[model samples]
Target: MQGHGYAQPVKQPPHIAWLVFLRVLFVVIGIFSIGFLTWAMMLRLAIVTRKSLDWGVFVAVLAANILSLVLLATEPGDEIHTAGGNLGITLLLGTLVAAIAYYLAADIRHFHRLHDAFTAHRSMAPAYGYPAAPSPYTATTVPSVPHTPPPMPHTPLSQPPIPAPPQRPAPARIDQVRAELDELSDYLRKQDGHHDGHHEGGR
Candidate 1:
């Protein structure tokens, strides 16, 4: 599907002044050790730039600040009297500040690099808010001829007649069977009577 012929405006890179302001803010907050606020700002910058080194520096500074605070609170009486423990705590606080400054510098450099790349990309992209040119070749449709299928061979509807099955003989009636049995019994009785007459004559 074709989109509406209007081109969309290109998005410009973020202003360099904003990044500078963030760096200044990060440095100030790091000097004061403003709890998690410094950590939050540093983390935000790291996330925006997708720079792991920036985040690592922030974490180191945060740890140093916390350690310094702990040392200040837990110093023993003798340790407080001695200059060595006090000097160590001071160094820790200084290290934290230095780490913060380093991270801010790295972040500013990253922003500049990002802005340069983005500007280059935008320059290379096609101009926005303009309609695309029409293609040189125009599409012409050829009229399609309606196709007719070839006629099939005609088959005769009449089939060969099937042969009829052979007929079975009919069964005998019950009255015929009973008449045959009666005839057989009459013959047996005549034979027995003849034998009895012969026996009486002999006696």
Candidate 2:
């Protein structure tokens, strides 16, 4: 029987932790009347990562931080104000802190997702110092022939013998042809003489 198998945990890049810490640090710094810095960092990160940025949220946070700073700086020392400026400063500071914290949490989540993507890409890449993978065209195994074939014997090719020219007719056959021609001429001459004698008698 086979034992249960467990999947290995995925590895993450080290920079992701640093990114999270930096974002959290910015949030902490923003608590000291400078929450606009956190918003600006969020906007920069969003642009770098091609993530969406809520401009409305950024404007509101910046405005609240600036107004809170102004109110605190202008407050008269130890004087009770009827304008409810204390409550107003408290509300603005609360809004700024909450917005900065929310953005920091979002940035952390974005960093994690980015890290996961980087991890997946790195895992798929070829490992260092390993032999290259065989090409797909050469992946199939083929058996090598054990013996070298002997070179084929180089035999000279044979050609047909050319025939000799036909022999000329013999001298004896040439004489016979001349004799037959002479006899034919004599017979023609006798026939012509007999025809002339018969024509003279009739005249």
Candidate 3:
């Protein structure tokens, strides 16, 4: 769970159908002595594949083919013409053969490089059909041990009881009645004096 997953497969570049057509033209040029067709095909393939070496080969071959053709055309006399034609044909055929060899070698090199890259990528990927091993750098969870509570201390069975607080005695009902009567009598005496003063004033 801690390790990396398998790497996704890499996508190859799209193959151009025109490049295949050029290769077919190369085969055709080998069988037929079509003048400068092989050089033309190589030039097209080089442009399609974007290979500088292929382009260079195409240029060199094209130049040789042109020079030979010019010499064959401008030479005077039958013998000189025959010799020039033969030289031109020989140079053309040799250039085509060299171009074919170069193409094959380039293809082999491309395949080998692709294979090496794929192999390196696969080697770094996680194993198939098995779970990844945990990493040493990752944190591991440890199960905690259940804690046991300590036993409670014992208490005496015959300990003395706690004493209740002392209570105050309440006043008797008769004393409460006597206090109220005294207040009532004082109020009555005041009322009587007030009536007597009012009567004297009226008189």
User: Which candidate ranks first by TM-score, i.e. highest?
Assistant: 1
lDDT of 2 by residue, 23-74 (tens): 7666676666444454565554556456445555666666766776667667
The residue pairs that clash in candidate 1, if any, are none
Worst 10 residues of 3 by lDDT: 10-19
TM-score of each: 0.47, 0.44, 0.43
In model 1, where do residues sit more than 4 Å from their true spots?
A: 1-11, 34-41, 76-84, 127-203
Runs in model 2 deviating more than 4 A are: 1-14, 34-50, 70-80, 124-203
Q: Rank the models by lDDT, top first.
A: 3, 2, 1
lDDT of 1 by residue, 63-114 (tens): 7656766666676774565455585477566675566666666676776776
Candidate order (TM-score) = 1, 2, 3
| Best model per lDDT | 3
On TM-score, the stronger of 1 and 3 is 1
TM-score, predicted candidate 2 vs. hidden true structure: 0.44
lDDT of each: 0.66, 0.67, 0.69
